[model samples]
Target: MAPFLTRLSGRAGFRLAAVSVTAMLALSSCGGSTSRSAPVLPDGADPHAPEVTEISALTFRAPIAAGIIQTSRGGADEEFGLNVTPQWIESSATAVSQIVAGDVQAAQSSYFGVIDAARQGIDVIIVSESYASNPGAASLESMPDSGITELKDLIGKKVAVVSLNSSHAVKIKDSLLDQGLDPAQVEFVELPYGQVPAALQQGTVDASSAQGATLAQVKDTLDTVTIFDYGDGKYNGMAESGWIMKKTFIEQNPNTVAAFQCALLKGTEQVKDEAVYAEILKTDLGFDDQAVASDIAPEFGATIRSEPLQLNADILKKIGSIDEDFDVASITLPTPDNCG
Candidate 1:
């Protein structure tokens, strides 16, 4: 059984988008929403409008960028366009704010957030599965010499995470429960993603749950590795990110949606290629040139179980453990056809 978390945890407009025909058509299908702050595309592709050769979509965080789906380069850079905008928000909770406010077109988010959003009547569709490991990738890390190899060892430990409502915190809580440890056995301190390593160094927190940059930082700076994954042998519902969309948008634009699926699915395949992936991470995603050329690229790929893995119903059920009646599936948008 996956440990239950106590709690868990966008779009742009067209006109400014003049990169590729595919991008223009994608944006054109989006229509116009002047009332909101979200990005607005110019009204469809005017034959008069110049052709967009490529478009840049943002990556939610660094860890997501490390996976096979991101590293591979087989996807249509010309068809779906290229360039991914990377964000600073490290956890699912923060990503939701930007999505609802229309800061970006889509994001890598916790399935729980998508479910919760659906429950709240937000029309969201999970288009793809970004990561799937048996134990899940989220874990507690401590100094090897700290003698803290087990969850029980965290009884009096100070742990750090981005925020209480963030996915990382939820992962920690679930990990503790999986080990039969009271979640409250350790004190959890909230810290920014950038500061997790420093907190550990200063002994401000004995350990922190890391993902992406924080995970990389821990390994590079402290040589830390996982104490244990929260999900252990099960899905634990920690299935990383789900690419989501607004319900209203999907209902109105089937053709456009299908185009996106075909393109992204192709991208997912490309992400699996190590050589191509390395190039995407450093160049398209904008990792430091030195980091890519010298350091190892992050590991990433789409989950095989899902053509674009859908959320686990059991995990959705578990989310209700904290928020009674929270049903993320209630707001699920229609799944795109022939996504496989």
Candidate 2:
């Protein structure tokens, strides 16, 4: 048995023990260890000020969202302010689940999660935008003689995804339908992200979904075929990730939320500048192999756009992931501007 805790609670005053995160706990442990001695905090950081001074958010370790919070300590040239302590969660799906369970006050999630929260009547509100350009960029790789070359060939084939109803599966179906192919023809199975490499080697799956960091890794190691790149013209304007929070929390902690958002946006602007990305990626994200696994561009912006979210809801409705059409504007809060 894997030695792990199914439920995790935040420290005092930020107690959020929500759900059983079986995979996140197990997989996160395998992530590369940090080489530095001291925590890589913002310059002149101070996290233990007071309830009024600190904001707590749950995100995956080394995610762009968390980096933004750490990079910009409230504002430029500000020695110390907006003391934020970022708690690491399992995945976007688990983060959304925790938001619904009320264990996580804030987390990074995609449109699939937004739609699910809408259908479940969860009072989750999206605060900031993380991505919007690339939809579900993936590649279906098989043996040279496997004879699986196109979408039509995927019929009766087993494709691996992180989860059954995950955004990857949903977007892959949308991509397939766009190609005038039947999505019901292909089969999908749930598998761990790490296990995909071995499964593909053993022919357990005809192809596996690849995105961002994982996609780069796949291209570097395997002799694979490129089936589809969702970031292209056909898949532009897809829903990206965003920071979500409970409505009540925004009502109660508006200042803290605004402060956090403004700081993150400043950091996002920094990320947009290519001149500083390499240093920041190595320092903030702790990526040892930055050359092989840099982040995919997603039209990262601070302002939340309604079009992508609406398009996502439409896609989810078509796939029966959601029952009714959702109003993206209703759940999205205006961009926070306390630091500016």
Candidate 3:
């Protein structure tokens, strides 16, 4: 509501310096052919002259990270002639900067981030769909005594969000509009997921939008009530985020993109198995018992669809996030046949 809030402070700093060191160590240990055995290739392929491609990817500490982690650990990447190394990133803004600077080739970004980037003349293509929200997967939360029992109660109240340009913010704003409430009446403050619970308890913000493990934490630790569910009503099964690459990078490295897509498809299928997903949460992401139990795994897929992305753009436009028209198809890559 604050002057068509697009860019919010405290959400764009780079955490790359520390992550780059770790990525370098991982690359050194994993890059040597002598340290690891020969990769298994498709039938009738030459192992001696394997056309392996190495790519560095940026990821967040969210449920979507599981697929890529499993892909690398499950040997899907190696099997597809790729050495995929993932670096944990702080935010989508940082990922965009890294991609443009050639520090990383690919990253997991929200649909809102992609649309906002396009409006700013930064060309990035969606290579694969990573996460779609399930019912009640994202929500607006407030303390029990906040007197905010319904959407209308939030008028003139401050709501904390990760970013004003985030998919969560757009969804919440759209929901407010659908309820016939003027979204500008409520103020959106930017806060990291880790600080949301504290901010709510300390009375810094009236309520906050939460998702994934953070949502699970607030429900467990605080006497909070969900004012609204972002996945409910007309927004059920909405595509939230996906893997993206610079348009020029995708054009120059078609085979690499295909391989990454194939491996991601295989990895997504693996996470659909409950046991496998739980293991990745406990072993890889370090989720506690409650966080793991309450985590609503997003609907993962590899194929990029135009409809959901177009819906996202429309919502952003309705909320006054972006003024220019965007063609969803222009930034989407065709799914590889093997991905199916």
The Cα local distance difference test for each model comes to: 0.50, 0.58, 0.72
User: What are the TM-scores, per candidate, against the unseen true structure?
Assistant: 0.66, 0.75, 0.83
Local accuracy of candidate 3 as per-residue lDDT tens digits, 151-263: 89989999987766677778777878888889989898777777888999999999998877888888888968999887777777677788888766765666677788888
Candidate 1 residues 49-152, lDDT tens each? 22332222334445465432342244343354333333434455445544554555555666655554444434456644565543434566887677787767
Error of 2 at 279 (Å): 2.8
**Candidate 1 TM-score to native:** 0.66
Instruction: Record all residue pairs in model 2 with backbone atoms less than 3 Å apart, i.e. clashing.
Output: none
Residue 239 miss distance in model 1 (angstroms) = 2.6
List candidate 3 segments past 4 Å from native.
Answer: 1-52
RMSD of candidate 1 to the truth, in angstroms, is: 10.9
Clashes of each: 36, 0, 1
The alpha-carbon RMSD values of the candidates against the true structure, listed in the order shown, are 10.9, 10.6, 10.7
Which candidate has the top score in TM-score? Answer: 3
